[model samples]
Target chain A: MEIVKKVVIAGHFGVGKTSLVSRFVHQKFSDQYLTTIGVKIDKKVIELEGATVKMMLWDIAGESSAMKIPKKYLAGAHGLFYVFDLSREETYRNLDTDLFELNKSLNGNPAIVLGNKSDLVEETFIEKLHSSIATDFKITSAKSGENVEEAFLQLAKEML
Target chain B: MNLNEIKFRPLEKKTQVIVFDQKGKVLETDNTLVEVNPEGVNIFEDTILCGMEEQFLSLKKGEQVELDCIHTDFFGKESHYDFVVMRLEEENPSYGLVIYDFGAQYNQLFDLQQERNMAQIQSHRLERENKELVDEKTTIERLYNEMKDDSSSSQYILVKADSLLYNLDFKEILYLEAYGDYIKVHTENKVYVTHNTMKRVEEILPANRFFRVHRSFIVQLSKIENIEQMSLLIRGKDKVIPIGKSYKSILLQKMDQL
Candidate 1:
């Protein structure tokens, strides 16, 4: 049987959600920042331990607030990658509330928080951010190719 | 009109209708937008439709499920649609999947959204730049204040020459000349060459005492012995510094004040 799952990459605007998708899907990185207008679907087939899963990556347009995201975009989403910019404190200050609303809309779907642009911040800053947030998040840098693949693979495995 | 001769027009021009059984199998389709498979028309082949299976199944008789802003690309041309799934009430009930193409309106909305988002990004970048400028100004003010408070440490400007730190007093310095990616600090008895720029040296020196007479030269006002045509003579030195056309008026005004 062919297993197919939908995963949505969502977060605040200018949070590098599109960059992460481009890095993971195309193995390419661009310094340009282009805003996504609507949902873009990309597919990748991952070979798991005992099963092959076709992961449909739905890169949704970022909203200023997680509650502002369209509910139609979250329909049938098996997993979600909630991303935020590491350099911007405003992006993650409301992480708890945003995650609460997003999870409510997802009906308790599995999600992973990602702090992107790790290269722009120091290790001490990352530690401070971790101490401040209640949820555990992976720090990634799409520009430097840091921990991007690992994060996507982890989410794909979780969905499986 | 006779019942067999009567026909109904579609509600939309670019529309697709797919009828499915309760088991999620495609029973019939007009094949307008959706591509048909050789074996059968399985609506589940589309990722968006496949994902909405649970929602479609939960619809009761006469109930409808709407998913808006669904995007699709056919042969390199992008299109947007609004999907409505309704369950029909009958003995052998079937489901209807109606796709209404609203690509034109959605494209307009996308353009507006793009413009708004770009403007937002520009605003954010400007805000960040403004904050950085504020921080830089604060630091410069703090340094200036600290220098002003310490009288003994304030009069001397520190310059590095040949890997040695030279503390030259403000009065002893006559002028500075720009020397190829470096500045030549001319003092009373010695000319010290330092790796610096004229603008930076001018910024560090007091505005009232030191004046930039030209693009490449900054002269101490107290050291000017005589002012000539488009040039000035420094006291105790025969060197004549050419005055820039634009700075001539400002120099004359400052000299008159002095």
Candidate 2:
């Protein structure tokens, strides 16, 4: 039987969450900025050694510390992706608070921390962040297809 | 009728009767009555009548009391019954308890309630399914538009400019230019700005009729007036589009030579 797992993709506004999902799912990228309303769902199947894992990806709208994340969107979610923009410092500053709220709502599920928009950021700053953050964080460029697949595979493995 | 004239009267085999003395003691009972209290004042499923016990015992001579109650029979079957208690005479008054069978009406009420509950559940289910159908329609429509954009045989293309959809023929397009987050479609009489990438524009435009002359421009092959070393002029327009050095040979190879 194929195991189906729900993964929620969440981040702040303009943080490249949609771009990352588009790159991974469609292998396409667009420069135009489209704001997501409510939530969008996509599906992908991963082949492991003895199992095929079907991931139902829920791309929710952007949430800040002030905005309340709708609880219905997080219902029955097995994992999460908390993305931030590498070029914007404000998206990084609210990472801890957003993760806290997500954890509280999901009762502490596993999550992947992704710093996107790496194509527009300085290499030195990204390298420094890799050392400061204790968890497994990936720096990705959704625009150039950099480390996008690796981050998804890593999350899928962790969920397994 | 006389106070003692109201003796035991026979009822249907399944019907239940309980005769109460002036002080509310059970004087007699039907053969179907089971599980009577040891004191015989109240019987099985009498819980519904507990509140009216005071009024039952205080009934005066020649007075009557009538009410409806839900009751369970000796076989533990339940039904609604019209209950009437009457005091026959003033001398040595006694109360007669007569229960009218309402099993058919009670069953009809139960059936109606079941039907109403089913209707409510069905209504909620239909609402949820309708929303799903609408969502499916939207997805199909978006996919259809994308498929049309990907088609190479079509002579017309649907373009969105300023949030409005326009179905323009391929010949009307002079050339497409890439802006930051928008594409400017320069036509014969006007320029329309739309949110799209140049890569997407290339996919939508027919490859045989259009050529990617530069990173920022896709020009119609039929509309090219003349090609300079660094720039090319399009018909019916004064603007010159720069040709990329990498695309120079491809542009030349695409031309029908003598």
Worst 10 residues of 2 chain B by lDDT: B43-52
For each candidate, what TM-score against the reference?
0.68, 0.38
DockQ (C-alpha) of model 2?
0.01
Q: Per-residue alpha-carbon lDDT of model 1 for B1-258, expressed as tens digits? A: 111111143457777666777666666666576564425545555545655567777777878888777665532446777777777645576777777778898888877887888788778778888998999999999998777656533488888998999988888999999999999999999999999888888888887788999999999998999989899999999999999999999988887654
Candidate that would win on lDDT: 1
Docking class of 2: incorrect
Candidate lDDT scores, in order, read 0.81, 0.72
**Residue B193 error, candidate 2, Å:** 72
- Candidate 1 lDDT, tens digit per residue, A1-160? 5677889898988889989988988899999776676777777777886787777788888888988898878878999999999987768879988888889866666899999999999999999888878999999999998999999889878877
Which candidate leads the pack in DockQ?
Answer: 1
Q: What's the true lDDT of residue A54 in model 1?
A: 76
Task: Tell me the tens digit of each residue's lDDT in model 2 across B1-258.
Answer: 532354445544445566666555666655354444526344212332332445556778767776543333323444555566777656766577766666676667656554654464356558767887999999999998777666644578788987799888888889999999999988898888999999988987777788999999999888998899989999867889999999989999998867
